[model samples]
Target: MSYKLSRRKFGQLALAGTVVSGLSYLTNRALAETPSLNIVGIGSTPIITTDQTTIPEVNTTELDSTAPDSVSTDIKPVGLVLQSLITGKAQVLADKSTPLLELNEIVSGFTSLSDGTLVVAITPITTSRRQATPTRITFLGTPVKTLIVSGLKQNQQLGSLLGTNDGRLIGLVGKKNGTPPIRLVDIDLQTGEISSISKVKFPNDERVSNLAECPDGKLYTSLVGLNGDTTLVQLDSNQKKPIRLGQLKVNGQAWNNGLQSLVCSATGQLLAFGAMRYETPNAVYSVDKNSGNMTRLQDFDTTQITRARG
Candidate 1:
């Protein structure tokens, strides 16, 4: 029961042990800080906290296959879930949270104002008809007031809504004219007035699923094509054609149900949320703005999520 080793061998072994121990500690700390979010229903708000790590991550609640299919393109989102990355909890902004207001319409877009007021674009339950009404809600799901956007005709469905740094809202809208062209509209927070910004006719007119304003003032959005292919694109004002970054490729590509949401992190990384349709794992991936490659950050052990509170 005696162990003997040369000075060099002993030094190498000690260094190896120290490296392993350091890695183990950092790994454990990360695990403890990452929030395990379980969104059982539409109202389950899982707050994401910054105390654990700087990178934003999300988790979803477990559900059975029989769980309601809420990720379909035709399905209108009833409510919004607001999750605070700094706090790591989600506020379910649904009927249970705001019982007075019936959130049965399609939530076209959501963004937070400069003063932290959550703005939501809501359309009719059936389809995009005329002008969709916008509402301002508090972080706790309380309805503050509603803004009537003018000049937007009836049947115009707002696609992607984003709040810019200058306290203005930018959104993608369909005019519902003969050939509805998706255009970007600048919304006035005070008057609820929408002014035409740019007519964005994407390549092949790819339907935009979501839009997020990056830290660098560029618009990043997710586009879904007719072939069930999803991609990330940059909608810059100076560029006539939208810049195609790359495909939002995940490990379980076949299992991904649909694009749920796309948000930009504080550090300017795009976070994409995908719903699991079949027997697959739901995941939240950090997307590369340049390459469109998705790096898996956290796996959600859940089925479907209605929407998050803005």
Candidate 2:
């Protein structure tokens, strides 16, 4: 169920003056404290890869995980909003019985502060829909604090986002009109300011489908080819080009570039959510960093459920 953000929690989030820094929820001690988390396998989903990243073999059903010590804190699942095409609002299915957050602006995407606080990018409810305001809010209440992210231009629109281990926010920058060069931009979470980091020029008009920051201090993005093949690439500032990691395989078949979303779990696992083309239900899968294999955990129909984040 949904609950209000407590005063103690609100006081903990002061992003205006002091810098906010901490680990992601998955890497945080909260999820680690759990004695053990079991994963039920659904046979072997092999991924052919020569990359060094390790992909553990485990499978589990669709799980609704909560904060470890949430009873006293009234914490809720980190929400990822999927805006409806018709209504232009977000809906999440974490707690199916609870109501969704009725946000006022178009939610571009969300990322977390180092301290586990969530920040959202929204195109403000004005006539112009170019730049977005980075916002931090009380999960349960109506108090929303908007921070002025500096250097964001009027022609750039923010897209999918992720928080890094270094306490920075990285996102895709799409042009408001024509096909401007696709680039990865960084946001100073402490200052609410944005800046261009690097240009990710993918051939064949392939854009960043999903992006996440791993525990090893590297950034990864999923790129789909024109032939429907999906490749996982790494963003290395030291290197001159994006390192091609490997291809993502689903159910022993080449995944046809339909990855709905990808997020790095607290424990460093690459969690992916996608539905097959013309498939009735959606399933959750985990990507092995070392091997590009994706094993299906469980498939469930979310026809009634909307958007989920965190």
Estimate the Cα RMSD of every predicted model relative to the unseen true structure. Answer: 16.7, 16.0
Q: What TM-score does candidate 1 get on C-alpha atoms?
A: 0.60
Clash totals for all candidate models: 27, 11
Superposed Cα deviation of residue 158, candidate 2 (Å):
0.7
TM-score of each: 0.60, 0.57
Poorest lDDT segment (10 consecutive residues) of candidate 2: 37-46
Whole-model lDDT values for every prediction: 0.47, 0.47
Give candidate 2 misplaced runs (Cα > 4 Å): 1-105, 124-143, 148-155, 176-180, 199-204, 299-310
Give, for candidate 1, the lowest lDDT window spanning 10 residues.
17-26
Best model number under TM-score? 1
